[model samples]
Target chain A: MTTSTPLQPVVQARGLVKRYGRVTALDHADFDLMPGEILAVIGDNGAGKTTLIKALTGAITPDQGEIRLDGKPVRFTSPMQAREAGIETVYQNLALSPALSIADNMFLGREIEKTGVLGSLFRMLDRAQMRKEARAALTRLGLMTIQNIDQPVETLSGGQRQGVAIARAATFGRHVVIMDEPTAALGVKESRRVLDLILDVKKSGLPVVLISHNMPHVFEIADRIHIHRLGRRHAVVRPSDVTMSDAVAIMTGAMEPPAQAA
Target chain B: MSTDQPSSAPRGPQAFEKVLPENEAPVRFEAERESGIKRFQNLLHSHPTAIPGIVLVASLVFFSVMVGGRFLHPFNFSLIVQQVMIIGIVGIAQTLVVLTAGIDLSVGAIMVLSSMVMGRLAVEMGVPTPLAIAAGIGIAALCGFANGVLVTRFRLPPFIVTLGTWNIFFALNLWYSASETIRAQDIEASAPLLIFFGQAVELFGARLTYGSIAMLAMVAIAWYVLNRTAWGRHVHAVGDDIESARLAGIRTDRVLLMVYVVAGVICGIAAWALIGRIGSASPQAGQTANLDSITAVVIGGTSLFGGRGSIVGTLLGALIVGVFRNGLALSGVNVLWQEFAVGVLIIVAVAIDQWLRRTSR
Candidate 1:
């Protein structure tokens, strides 16, 4: 058997432990996400995949863990700190304002202001410039079906809203884009569009962390699957080696873990 | 492309196809046909000032036709402006609170209380006129900050907080003013600055007060801030969906607190206008100002639900009330009937707002 030497993980977690009173959410969990690869994390209910992501994204500080980004140990105490470090998370609820236009929603917190007196003296937003950039971002993602960039988000269909959310994450994300349930709330066609957008994100040179329950989707897109069980990494297996049932069985703890972790 | 399958290593191209999705299909869908009413709703929703603007014009036409040349005269038009000046100023403050999905029922009390402080400090306590005025406006802003704190820190609903503070401020006004109206002559003698806004400028047969012109300027400044600035967008975003705003990194509590403080400052200015308009500082003054201001905001097409509406619409709304009352009275309508007409307009305006809001869903 020929084995290729693997590059160091872009984001790595080791010995993560979190306790909520008497409950142990994460017990010495270890995680690895290699550079430029789609990594899928699958687990059953109460298996602590969320806790693991929270620890990695700085939403919560684990009681014990060392997180490394690009081989440098870092500590983040807030989501903003994580975001500043080139990690953008597309939350499941999307966090979009319905009454605001697409451009306004896209530039909600970090708005582009006009230059000179209009911007500094009057504190005016550069609406035209923001609209232009918003259009460019949408076009880059091939999301041109939305003709009016000024239309309110409530006017959009479910799939379109998801598309905008992904486009937002893609535009700002520098190194890693983490999506929690990107396709869980979508219809069949909407899910398909989301899957394509995910690949587009990867193709644009950003690694993606997809957390989902869709087995076929996991097998189809993920280069490697991280099966989590009992608050720790059970095994890392190549998608080409594990069958869907075997992945599910290992996740649910009905089968032994693979001998060789990918 | 790298493949993990050792057995399927020879099937290189097909192996890549197994993991990667097929070429994405172009997003295919046509725009849905919208009914005319829906389109109109969209138009009105985008430009909230249109309906109230139309209503103001329609009211003018209806009154002029019903009452002839007297109603259309510039003098009569100025009378309408003078009548609505207090409500117009107070309504600006109310519009700010309402735009945040909150209602300030204590605005009338705040204005009256601030005026009493201005009058008592200048005329009775012998403070400099400018200092008294500054103190009054400052006190009003402090009162507003208190409301903001109680709402944001305690996590209380604004309606409940303002409703409680309204009674507190009203009681405070009664105590501080000794339930007595400051006579206009004492203010005229001691502090002419107290009534500065009441001074009139005659132009083209129309007598316009400094207060009325100030109200106009205030409206313009407010419109610029709400439409042109980042803070204004955050205000809308916070009101529209607070959770989303917070997730987007807006400090929602601070935004909400600032909104209340700004509303209070506007109220203080309204108090100055009130003192000038009525020629006295009476705890009894502005008894109906709260409801009247609310009436103007609603009639102007600013949504009670917040995250929508404009100050221009609010100006038109205050005018609508003024014209309706003056026009109805000129046409010999009974006072009770004029009140009834205003009540009907309020209901209709709210109904239209509710209808307009439905298009978003």
Candidate 2:
């Protein structure tokens, strides 16, 4: 479904190369994420999905690649640099301390402090500001039933945790949000809620990169699908151009055999 | 809206009447057993580091009771308080390092070196007593700085770093003093600082020593710094999971460095408390102080794994050890038996600490 005007892509990467010892993890992969479009990266286990995300998010450095944020070349040495450059990633492990409260996890390292001697001497955290903003962010994602922002994350269910993570990623108004299997472990209802949250994120005018192996769920939400086979991005297909059967055939490599003869 | 409401009225009551939880009794019963076993398993796993403190206390109590309660007297209580003051104060510094999953084994030697710095300043260099005190603290800070840099910058394990410094300071102590004891009247005219130990407040047939108050104050400050401040949070975070804390943008190395420096400064304070109590300073003084303080810290509830513990527990541990020793001496249990008792106490305390750690998790 192409619009009258072409949307400017938020993230563009080309010829990404990564090697571990002798085995290549990602080899010459290319990807483009347009603004307001949900792009899905589908692959089997150890199919370079994790490596590609890590490289794009600057968690790991690739030997050869150019990542542009809105067409400007940039390099990130640390996750902090990537965060500042507006690339937020919510990993499968979720990286949130269970003992800490939801608000505390949201602002764990980047706490807002009052400027004064007490602030320096006592390191007084601005708890009120963080709570208010965290609540607003959760509410924007339609998670209003979670009235207690100070509750420890350990008490939350899996879907609630994912919701909090998505809220954290989008609350910063990041240019690109990468979610690793946001609904993989969730049940049907929870998965539906997560999909709706992803839609909300896209509607807020930000691009999303979703990595999952669930084809039906991917078909339900993604506008464009990229399949990785043997450490390379084999193809990018629009959901409208291909049926579920064709997509599965392409993924399983049963279709388009002997294209080398052409 | 009315059509929808009318359709749901009969069905809503029927749905409410169909109670389901009562039918799932077996599932609920299994869930209870599973959580119960999990909680029990958690309780059984304790840390080895906290055992020393408990044995110190329990044995001390057993000895005091068996020794005809000689440890319960007011005079003997004051003596025990005075005896533990130096060790307790130095233990505060040790506590800071241990909280960061690190240790400063050189604390005993640092005390000796600081005394030498003060001895040289006042006795050899002809400086005022106050200036000498400041110089002692400065020397302690510098020594701490060296320890901090070596450990943090080089990424060396703290145990090895502090062990190396312990010997270094021991050598420095002998080189500076030349095996001579710095007497009280050498430079400072007032013997009151030295005699402060003998002087006790007599109130209604009981007297309390000033050294006990100073020790208590030091404990209070240590407790506050470890529990209350932002610096304390950083210490726990760094100790708990350094990489995660760093990813959160916490300056972990700097926090570790400051912890060591603060520990060193506290050592200097302990040196003064030692000098005030004994009225003399020598290179050989505080030789066993490190072991005593470490034992006391272990007996306290603080885990060596870092990120969990309290200063109050440490102080209680110190008092327990002190009381036991004083009680044994007053009741004539012999020094040989007293040492044996202390050794046994260390083992028991460590065992309990391990148990507590397991239970908490």
Candidate 3:
């Protein structure tokens, strides 16, 4: 509905295909993530939404596809490469080591080494700096309920753990943040807090690609809804132009996608 | 109302006045203050080595009291240090492996085999002593690399892989050494350096062996590496949660491989220490060392479940075992009873570890 003029996309994938044994997980799916917008991906069970996201995030390689970031073709062989390309993913399981302290978890893969010879020779981590920055990042994201950055992640509540995971992504995510069902395991209050955090992330001027099954949450925050069905993108609609039932109907193939959204 | 009193009269409806009675704040459940016992449990859980340290001290005191202060002598104390040095050294390798949530049952086998290499090469083949020692260490590292490859590339469970290797290495040791025990006289004559750690120095009227000093230095270095290095953190992360570590972009396979290799190298060093302690390279030596090192690690507060342990705790653990055995012997306890006590100590140590873990949860 807001498409008064065509806008360039931040990320685009074309003709993506993946097969697992005899099952076609993704069947030539095409997708787009516009710049500075919340793009919601909704699909039914076995609809291949996860495969598409995995392919996009370099968690898995597609059988055939052309992916462009900033209009430049890029291929990531691993999640680490994707991260280096400024694509950070907050997985549904939260990917945080329970035994590690919050600050340690925040800087898990990308640890800050101390300056000078000690760091180079001994690979010594700058624990104090990491702790300080972890605290500041959490505070900036309004995650002040966590009193101790040194406390192990297992000690935190579900909401607080999710907050830490989001804080980590926000801190390091230079270009785009991708979340896979961030609020799926949270209670009502916690989900609301996470929703607020997503909005906060959006306000900071980063594009987000959110994958969720919750219709209301998607409609409430999404600028554009991508309905996945039969292992492909079935429809892409503005949230304002489609009802929840209409989106569901198109996802389950009860109705065809509206012509304007095709 | 009088005009003069109009100003004092209440407004038609004061903004501050409550429209309805304010509801009492919703009842919230605050966690109750921890009791003394709970607090103690928390402390023990946070510092797993504390219980073992206490047990070690208590055993020392008990032995002193029972033996009428004989066990408190500097001579006996230094002897205990000497007796525990082999196990202490081997426990370093075990501690590194266990930190990655892996068990190296072949550590004793590796040490024995490596020492055999040192003995045969130096004595039978007439190779230089230093080169033989280096080759022995290199062979141990090679075996470790095999274990790492099997565990990482083949995706085999470390326990099964190491258990298999344990038998393989033992068989190799028997075959290679031809089941012959190198005599102490021959070792001292041909390869004097092999028995170098057997030399002792008088420290404050107590005899301290080079073997014991080497063991302590090894533990100190392990402590520094595990606590202060990035590689150490990687090992912990891999053990704590392999999937999470992988997702964090850590090369979990590489970490596991390095852990195995480093553990092998440490076991090789322990082999050198073993030669010094025994003054001979015998295929039969370190028979019980596998289980003994595990006991030390468990008692030292390093979790067999992995990712949470300390080298200092392991050192203290080895010392506790020594004190128990020495104390029991001095107190006229039968050898059978000493073995039985160690068994009980192992069970108690593991139980304490489990209980501490529960408190943290």
lDDT of each: 0.87, 0.75, 0.87
Whole-structure CA lDDT of model 1: 0.87
Residue B341, candidate 3: Cα error in Å is 1.4
True-vs-predicted CA distance for residue B340, candidate 2, Å = 4.2
Candidate 1 regions exceeding 4 Å error are A1-6, B1-32
Error of 1 at A212 (Å): 2.0
> Model 1's DockQ?
0.38
Please report how far candidate 2 places residue B24 from its true position, in Å. 8.7
Q: Which CAPRI category fits model 2?
A: incorrect
Error of 2 at A39 (Å): 3.9
Q: Tens digit of lDDT per residue, candidate 1, span A84-131?
A: 788878878787888889999888888899999989999989999999
User: Which digits, one per residue and each the tens of the lDDT, describe model 2 over residues A1-262?
Assistant: 4645766568888898999999899899887888788899987677787888888888888889888898889887777788889898877767665545688667766676646975676666666888898999999999977879987565577888889888988987479999999988886556767888998999998889999877666776888888776677777876656665666676677775223210
Q: Write the per-residue lDDT of candidate 3 for residues A139-218, one digit (tens) a residue.
A: 98899889999888877878899999989998898888999999899865677678878888888878899999877678
Best by TM-score: 3
Estimate the Cα RMSD of every predicted model relative to the unseen true structure. Answer: 4.1, 7.6, 7.7
Candidate 2 chain A lDDT trough over 10 residues, lowest sum: A253-262
Tens digit per residue, CA lDDT, model 2, B1-361: 1212211122111232245445658656855775765655443332222344455566666766776545556666677778888888888888888878898899988988897788777767777667888889888998898999999999999999999999998899899889888876763463234334335677544566666677788888776665445566567667655765665556788999998899899898877777767777777899988788887777675668775566877787777678767777777778987788678767766675576555442
